[model samples]
Target: MRKLLAATLGILSAVGGFVDVGDLVAASQAGARFGMAHSWVLLLGVVAICAYAEMAGRIAAVTGRAVFDLIRERLGARVALLNLVASYVVTVVTLAAELGGVALAVRLATGVPYLIWVPVAGAAVWLVLWRMRFPVMERVFGLAGLALVVFAVALFWLPTDWAALGHSAVSGGQAGQGWGAYWFVAVALFASTVSPYEVFFFSSGGVEERWGTADLADARFSVLVGFPIGGFLALALIATATVVLRPAGLTVTGLEQVAHPVVLAFGGLGLAIAALAFFAVTFGAALETGLSAAYAAAQYFGWQWGKRVSPREATRFHTVLLVSVLLGVLLLLTAIDPVALTEYMLIISAVALPLTYLPILVVANDRTYLGDRVNGPWLNTLAAALLLVILAASIVAIPLAIGTRMGQ
Candidate 1:
């Protein structure tokens, strides 16, 4: 029972990352623009994140330390500091994007402008982070996020061409969108799939839950089951978009378009469910990113951290969390389009991907940490190949964005 319950950690982490606001838009955009051509990217990202997150969870369980804690020691202070700065920036921006998502979700429901809900969403997220029991928070939002399954169900109800979808996945062409735009979308989706904060939150959450060697099996279970579910949900979003929006020549300007297929299939109920799903996932992710930003800072500096400790005891960590939420709120108040912000966040995350992932790969192999529990040859080889892909994404993300005008 405990093991099953513990799976919430993985589910929440995956739910938060895979279906977060940025991913919601990015995946939809990919499908709308390029059909299912980006399916391989999602698959590759799931494999990469699962392999690394398992390493991270194992490290946390075995060493009683978060990944950031060991990163400074293993990678040197200078490199770790740089990584910390980049990751922290990306995470906070992501938090802002998520808070924006929460507001957008509310707006979708209430017919209110999303801007009015920005501060409200920010406050709600901060309050949950400040007071909610960690496990309760994880379970509540993780389960709620599964509401996105409506998209998959809609595929059957809609006039979806499964054979065409399969051909798009297998053929893997540009769909006349041009190679640059396709790869731009590819990098953004990849970044969203393997966002650094997901690992930060997952490993830190493991340490907070006091995972030990005995809990290793549960940790592995979380990684294996959680991330792939995220990928599957994301694929469903892509499939729906491919079926509905692509045929109509519509692009995902907002969540409304993303929910269009569901709405067509189920009408009012579909819209309601999609809005609820959006809110839960975004709010859930807001919590993860906020805590992750604080975790990265606290772990990097060796300060006290984690929800197990009271806010008074972990004042710096709590302060960072509060500040991050506020920043996210303020950013959204500027009326910057949430989807645009998410796109920019993905570009930055793609560039900084190597910094967040490379260290985990290095430390996972270190005898000082995992000993015999270190990655086997097969996992290491897979991780290495994935890292090369990450590096390629990082190198090309900016050029592709510039050349394609952010996938214009």
Candidate 2:
């Protein structure tokens, strides 16, 4: 029971990474435009993230270090600092996007404007980080995020064409959206699923919880079970959109449109449930991204970090967390469209994926870190293949964005 509870960190990280604002829009857009053709991308991303997260968890449990810490050691401070700069920028932008998501979810639930909720959301997220017990925080949000299962449930209630959905999953096409747009959405959804912050939060949460070799099985169990569940929820979002939005020619311009199918099927009750799920996942992601931003900086500098210590003890880390949330709030105050921000966030995250992932692959195989616990042959094979796909996504992300004019 204790071990099972510890998996909350994995669940929180996966739910945040797999279905935050980015996935909510990207996955639905894929479905709205291309049916279930992009389902394979989500599946591949789940496999990739699971394999790497298992390695990251193993490293943290055995070595008492997170991925960013290993990067500084293996790649030298100069290169790692550069890596940190890129990662920090991407993460802060991601933090901003999540804050916007939280506000949007609030606006969906209440009649108040989303801008009014931005700072409130940021303050609330910071408060939770400032005072909550780490595991308690993880479990609360992870459990709440399961409210997204409403999407899957709503699917069953709706008159879904199961055979057609399965056929589209097996036989992918551009659905008249053009291969360029199709692949662009594919890359974005894939990037969201394997977002770097997921691993950062996952491994850092393990370290914060003081995982050891004895906890390795529990960590692995978390990634294997938690992430796929996240992927399933995301797939349900896609399936719902395919069934309800595609034929209507709706393109999911915001969170409200994402909830349309459920609202149509179950009316007001469904809208309320969708809003709760949206708030939980986005607020949970805001927490993860804020921590991930600080985690990257603290781990890079070898500073004292983790919520296990007093705020005064880890002042620099906590300061970064506070500042990151403030920055996010400020970004949202500029009144940028949260959906558009998420689209941009996904593209940039795609470009930065290799910087975050390559070092993990290298260090996971290093006996210096894990000794006999290093990645086994099959894991290495999968990690290497996934790295190639990540690289392809990174190499092409900007060009595709430019060429397709952000997948017009």
lDDT values for all models: 0.90, 0.89
Model 1 spans with C-alpha error above 4 angstroms: 1-13
Candidate 2 versus the native: TM-score?
0.97
Model 1: per-residue lDDT, tens digit, 3-67?
66556656665565556887899999999999999999999999998999999999999999998
lDDT of 1 at 153: 99
lDDT of 2 by residue, 1-408 (tens): 765555666565555555688888898899899999999999999999999998888999999999899989999999999999999999999999998988999999996999999999999999999998866666667777788888899889988999999999999799787888988999999998998998998889888888999988877887888889999999999999999999899988889989999999889999999998889888888889999999999999989998878999999999999999999899889989989999999999999999989999999889877789988898888899999999999999999999999999
Say which candidate scores most in lDDT: 1
Q: Which stretches in model 2 have alpha-carbon errors above 4 Å?
A: 1-17
Tell me how candidate 1 scores on lDDT: 0.90
lDDT of 2: 0.89
Candidate 1, which ten residues in sequence have the lowest lDDT sum?
A: 9-18
RMSD of 1: 1.2
